[model samples]
Target: MDADFLLIRKMKQGEDKAFDLFVHKYYKEILTYCNYHCPNKEYAEDLTQETFVRFFAKLSDFHYRGKTKNYLYTISGNLCRDFYKKVKEIPVEAMELTEKTEPMEHQMTDVVNKLTLEWALKQLPDEFHEVLILYYFQELKLKEIADALKISLPLVKYRLKQARKQLERLLGEEEIYESGSKTCEL
Candidate 1:
């Protein structure tokens, strides 16, 4: 039995608390995605609100066809696009993206490495950046990414492949592949 199916059944049965549970589960992830896309924390909060509002409004159409996370992200991604279109006049590229200050415990090398990586990601086109962030940072499955992007599975694979190649080029070196482990480490 799929736990997501059970949750959807409970939600369909008019369990008002189910929506709250769902929000609590996905709120942070949705917000993080919004912040990354919009690069403004307060506006991202509003986008997150729009995401949940749309989800609840469309609740009657909900089904267990895919993981709820996939559904939520699809909604969030669409909202992000809509928000951008609405605010198309504003040049978000000119607005500086403020990085939340992290604790100074890390060594200088680690900080530089992180900064370099962020720079590299920013240098990529939006499509490459989106695929890399969804696959690596958010830890979403390729299928989930396909569903969220509303793209075919094979296209998702191709995008991921292209993103990896671009990242290697941007990083100036390729990570050493660990055979059988499915991971590449520097």
Candidate 2:
């Protein structure tokens, strides 16, 4: 197991390898999460870099009271929040459609619906978005997500329910059509 505790210990002792290991483990996830939340790739990339920089600067102060991933994610989330505050004057509507769409398994008609769900996720309140992403994409259990987001399990369930309802409202019949139909293996 990649013990984040060990990594943090090495990091606190100023080991370069530990820092490299941390980046290797988290860079993709951090970038993906930030990109999903931010308006543009440039902003996402900047936030990702800033998150790591802040993480490194604060490594010595880390108390290891929780999973390193959760702690790191909390830091990343805070950086994203700060960025959002700075860019608050920019219209949210203007931020939409900045991401380029590529060919998906579903056609354009369905792509809009899929993107609608994703965009709605991005638009969700941070707590709901964090819980949903941690639970679904990260595949963490409710308890794990609650620990990660520092919320209670009941609150995690409630947020997940709200997120699902919102997503269903955005996806609607498209979800049924895609899921109810059988898939043929090539």
Candidate 3:
């Protein structure tokens, strides 16, 4: 059996240390996922902690539907959605952003691009944004993303394609063909 199953088994047998290890392994990842939504480190940390709490509470009900990492992401996503609903965050625009230091040409361009990209990502529908974050930013495989999102493989593929197209449109890509060909590999 794989290590996932082994870890689950240990946790099921009431091994506190195993669960602690599991939490330790995924803590940083879950926090990072939350940060993609909230941007504030403290808020993301709270969301991450809540994700772990919810996951641990529902551990027995987890019937090996997918990997634990994906499950945690799903929980994190849901919590973030809830949080955003209440606060209705407005992302900062690229032009409105100030430089942190004297930036070289490449670094300035990179920062502006990243900020624009983040804003563009927010412009996308929540589902599309989630898929893009999972596939591109988090570097999850299509299949893994599918499993994590609890959707079919084809739907995941379709959403990813649509997200890329939407991003290119939002960013005003000159070469549609070249942008479409990007598979978002890490």
Candidate 4:
């Protein structure tokens, strides 16, 4: 039997410890996903809580057809979409850049690259941005992302390809603006 199946079984039997274990296992990941969608930390926290709440509420109906974590992501993604509809905000939290001992000049370059990537991601449509976040930031497999987002596998591939192209264009534009010279070779 799958571990998640056992966990769900225990949870369904009203075992508080099982529920706690489930929450502890996935809370940080879900919160990180929500943070990518929502700029406000507080709101992201709320969305994370709500994702668990909805999952627990539907626990009885949830069959272990896929990974539990993916389901949580789906719930959080829906909640984030609803949040965007109400708030009309496009703010996104940037993924953390790697920390390493480097010279000041290299550090500054890393910061600029991070900012430029963040800006480019924000410029992408929600569909494209979500795929990039799931694939790159959250490190989800392509099939996992398709299952989580309830999208077709081919569609996911298409979106990822298009998103990369768009990001390249956006980042190229930023480089030109910053350096006052075209740096990207088309």
| lDDT top scorer | 4
Candidate 1 per-residue lDDT, tens place, 1-186, comes to 876677678888889787678788789988877766665567778989898888878878876785678777778778877886787544445444445475555544554665576567667777777776677656677888887777888988898887778778878766543323245443
Ten-residue stretch with the least lDDT total in model 1: 177-186
Alpha-carbon deviation at 57 in model 1, angstroms:
0.4
In candidate 2, position 47 carries an lDDT of 85
Off by over 4 Å in 2: 89-111, 174-186
Alpha-carbon RMSD, candidate 3: 4.5
Query: Against the true structure, candidate 1 has what lDDT?
Result: 0.73
Write the number of the candidate with greater lDDT, choosing between 1 and 3.
Answer: 3
Candidate 3 residues 34-60, lDDT tens each?
Answer: 877875667888999999899878878
Question: lDDT score, residue 127, model 3?
Answer: 84
How much does each candidate deviate from the true structure in C-alpha RMSD? 5.1, 5.4, 4.5, 6.6
Winner on lDDT between 2 and 4 is 4
Candidate 3 off by > 4 Å: 90-111, 174-186
Instruction: Give the true-structure RMSD of model 1.
Output: 5.1
Better of 3 and 4 by TM-score: 3
The models' CA-based lDDT, in order, is: 0.73, 0.72, 0.79, 0.82
TM-score of each candidate? 0.69, 0.75, 0.78, 0.77
**Model 2 over residues 1-186: C-alpha lDDT tens digits?**
448878888899889999999899999888877765676767878888888998888777778764877776778788888887887655445454523465554455554654675576766777888776666555567887887788888999999888767766655543532321332111
Q: Candidate 4, after superposition: displacement of residue 120 in Å?
A: 2.7
